[model samples]
Target: MRTLRRSTRGRIGRIDSRDAKTGIGAAELPALAGGRIERVSVAREQDSVASRFAERIREEEELRLSPLAARSYPAVRVRPEEDCALRTPFQRDRDRIVHCKAFRRLTHKTQVFVAPRGDHYRTRLTHTLEVTTISRTVARALALNEDLVEAIGLGHDLGHPPFGHIGEEVLDSCLKERFGEDFRHYEQSLRIVDELERDGMGLNLTEPVRDGIVRHSSRAPLPETLEGRIVRVIDRVAYINHDIDDAVRAGLLREEELPREPIEVLGSSGSARIDSLVHDMVEHSATAGDIVQGPRAGPAMAALRDFMFEHVYLGPAVRAEHAKISSVIRRLFEHYVEHPEQLPRDLAGGDGTAAEDVASRVTDYLAGMTDRYCIRRYTELQVPQAFAR
Candidate 1:
C-alpha cells in the first residue's frame, strides 16, 4: 500500500474528490472511499497495465480549475452493490439499457426504412450502432470520456416514437393539442428513459449521457466536456448523411441533388460523407483557437442543413406519406381515448389517463408501434385492414 507518484491514470494517492479525475469507466469507477485507490484507469490509458493501471495521484496541484475537467458524478445505485465487485460505469449503463424494455423495442423502431424491409436497411438498432461508433471514436480522439459518450449514443433515440421521427412529430402534435404541452422526442427520450423505461424503473443513466439525450436537438447543450460535444456533432453528422441515403432509396431525392458544399467538402456518398463531415468538425474543433468553433460552423453548415430541409425533408414524397401517417396516429389517439380497454394491460387507471386521456393513449399506443404496425394501424383506422393484427 505504498503511494506512487506518476503521470498516468488509476493511480493511488491522497486526492480530493472535488479535484479527482479518472478515465471514464473503461476500467471501473474509482471507489468512493475519498482516500486512496488500489488500481484505477484514467479515461486516457496507455498500453502497459502496470503503468496505465499503475497508480497516479490526482492531488489538488495537478487538477484543472475549469468545469470541463471536473470529476464525473457518482455512479447510480444499481443492484448487487457488493462494494468490491462493483460494475464499471459503462458496464452498468450497458446492463441498464439491456434490461430496459425501451431498448428492446428499438428492434422494431424505424431508422428510415419500415419494418420487414431488407435486413440491412438500418432499423433504429442499426442507427444506434452507427451513432455509438461515431461518438466513441470522436470522444477517444478528443481525449474525452468514452463511456459517457457511448452511454449517450445508446440512449439518444430511446424516446423516438414507433415510426421514428415521423411518429414522434405525430405524437408531439397529437399530445400538444390535448395537454397544451409539446412532447419533443429529445424530451420524451429523457422522460422515457427516466420515467417509463423498465416498467418505470428508468435507465437512471449518468448526468453526461442524460444531458446529451436531453439536448440532442437543434439547440445542442453547452457541454461540460469534450465527450458531449462529440456526441452532439456526430449525431448531426450521422443523421444527415444517413437520411440522405434513406431518401435516395425511397426516391424522395436523388443523390445528384445534394448541395455542392457538403458534397464537395465532404463527399457524395453516405459513409464517405459522414467521415468527411466528422473529420472536418473534429479537426476544426481540435485545432488551437478553433477547438470548439461551435458558433462558427453554424453559417456554412446551416445553409446546407436548410437546403436538405427544403429539398429532401419537406419534399412532396415524404410529406405526402407524413400526412397519411399523421392522420393514422391522430385517429388512433381519438379511438383509444374514448375506449381505454384497447390500451395495454399496464396503462389503465393511471394519472396519465385521468388528466390527459387522449395524450396518454397516444403515448401508450405510439410507444409500442413497429414501423409496419404504425402503417397498419393507419390503414385500419382509415381504410379497414383486411387482415388486422
Candidate 2:
C-alpha cells in the first residue's frame, strides 16, 4: 500500500498518489510545489474508525444520559490539547490515572491491615478498584457519567500514605507540630495529580476528576459534579464494607458482634450490604438529581461506619501497632526534615525557600512510601550497620 506524506499524528498534507509512493523519510521536498498535490486526507483508515467511536460515545451520552450527568466531551483541562481519536476526555483521564506511577504504588500500600498474613486481604489498589467498580454501577444506573465517576474513583486515594489511615494520622501530626499546617490525604491527592506526578508536570487531569479526587473524603467539601459525588459517597461505602471483611479475617471483629440494627437494615454479608447501599444510592440519586442514599440505607450505613470506627478502627487490636507505626513515621519525618537534601531534588526546595517548604517536601517524600519501604527505611536509619545490611 502507498504511504502518504503526513505529520507524526498521521495527519496528511495535500499530496498525490505518485508522491505517496515516495515514502518521505528524512528527505525534505518542495511544499506542494506548484499545487501538484490534491486535498489532504487520512493516511490510515483506522483513524477515521477510531474517531467515529469517540464521536458516537459523545452522541449517545447526549441522547441517553440524564441532563444532570457530566459530559465526557469538551472536558476542561489545565493544559488544553487535541482530543484523542479513540477516547473521550474522561476515558483518557481514566487511562492516565490507571497507568501512572502513583497508581502502581497503591498495590503495595496498605488498605486496612498493615501487613496481613493472608494474601486475600485488600490492599490500597484493591480498595480503589472496588470503589471504582461500585461508583461506576451507581453512575450507570443514575444515567450519570460512568467514565467520569470511574476516573474520580480510581484516582481518589492515590495520595494515601503507607500503612493506611494510621500513616495519615502520623503524617498529619508531624506536619502540624513542625509547620502548623494540616496534612489531609485528599488534598495531597490533588497535589499528586496537580504537581507531584509526572515529575511535577502533573497528570493534567480534567477539572472534574481533580475536584472529585480532592473531595472524596467526607471531611472535605462535596464534589462539584454528581459523578464526583458518587465517588465521594461510594468511597465510604467501599471502605466501610471491605474493612469489616478485613477486620473479621484478622480476628479483630466477629460477625455476631456487629451492631444488630445496622446489620439487619443493611445485610448480614458484605456483598449484601454493598448491593443494598448501591441500590439505595441509585434510587435516591435518580429522584434527587444528586448522589444520595436512601433514609434506611444512609442511616444504616452510617451506623455500620460508626461501629467500625469504635470496634475495629480505633479498637485495641488495630491500635496495638499504633505506637510502632507512629515511631517509624515520626523518626522518618524528623530525618527527612533535618536532612532535606535526602528528599528528591524537586521536592527539596532550593536555597532561600522557607523552612516550612522543606518540611512540606519531607512530608511528601514520606507520604509516598509503601509499608515495607517505610519500614526498611526506618530500619536502615535506626539499626546498626552490621545488623542493618
Highest TM-score: give the candidate number: 2
User: What does candidate 2's lDDT look like per residue over 223-247, in tens digits?
Assistant: 9999999998988999999999999
As for candidate 2, its clashing pairs are none
> What does the lDDT read for residue 159 in candidate 2?
91
Whole-model Cα lDDT of every candidate shown, in order: 0.63, 0.86
**Lowest-sum lDDT 10-residue window in model 1:** 52-61
Q: What tens digits encode model 1's per-residue C-alpha lDDT throughout 1-389? A: 22233334434444332423543332445543456664565533444423432122123313422234323334434332321123445556756775677777888887754442355566887788788898877665655556677777888777788766777777878777777767777777787767676665666676666777788666555555566666666776777777777777767777778777656656667888666666666676665422253443444456566876787666665566687677777888767766666677564235444656546545755766766677676677767456654
Q: Score residue 242 of candidate 1 by CA lDDT.
A: 78
State every prediction's TM-score relative to the real structure: 0.73, 0.88
Model 2 lDDT at residue 261: 93
